[model samples]
Target: MVKKILIVCIGNICRSPTAENLMRDALNHADIEVASAGLAALVDSPIEPTAQAVLEEQGHLPSAHKAVQLTSQTVNRADLILVMEKRHVTGVLGIAPEARGKVFLLGKWQEDREISDPYRQGKPAFVHAYALIEEAVHAWAQRLVG
Candidate 1:
């Protein structure tokens, strides 16, 4: 049983937070738990405003999102870890080498794609990132739950 999921990105503000919320919404009734963290987090920053707005448009709330740094403890706790890009997976493995097989691109199931970061980009980039997250999370939820 895949009980715990961890979503990862460069910063917790944009990609990972959105993926976390989308997974939470999709797996609402499942026994799994979902959370997100950053490769290089801001520590105390809230989710980016653009990310929050994009999630809201999808009827998901990101108000509780808080930036967290990826750590060994979190890596050990998660049964699965979905990362925004291949570089994120590489970076995370450098920190927690034991998380080899369990870490993968968020778009791995769909043509082994990578979700690009929209960090300082404008609204359009944020929208694109959000759409990718939503699609990946939905597919992940379906496969894990069913």
Candidate 2:
């Protein structure tokens, strides 16, 4: 029933997009589509280079992602929306209060873990975030694909 999934973070260039691409690879479900958007998006931007590099190191060829902003319409379109942190949940609900039921933390299974932003940080930070995202994505994939 979850045909569309949206991942959200502060900026689409980092965590959310990483999770989006990783989920797309992990899910590989024909009926399901995974995408990412930012609470305050760097619209029309590509994935941050460091984040892209971390993904590449793990053999994931990052998609040609153009950052998008979270909107009520986008929120309504998704059967499920996953965010990086608690504030993101607030941000999404502010746009579409009716979506409270569908929005959840990306780390819902990992003790409700929160993924931190690595933008302007460094490769090490991006690497750390990627590991967390990858773990969470696999957990969701198992449930969704099962």
lDDT of 2 by residue, 1-146 (tens): 89999999987999999999999999875579998899999999999998988899999988899999999999999999999999899999999999989999999999999999999988899999999999999999998988
Q: lDDT per prediction?
A: 0.90, 0.93
Candidate maximizing TM-score? 2
Lowest summed lDDT window (length 10), candidate 2: 27-36
In model 1, what lDDT does residue 9 have? 93
TM-score of 2: 0.98
- lDDT winner: 2
Residue 128 Cα positional deviation in candidate 1, in Å, after optimal superposition: 0.6
Please state the error at residue 9 of candidate 2 in Å: 0.5
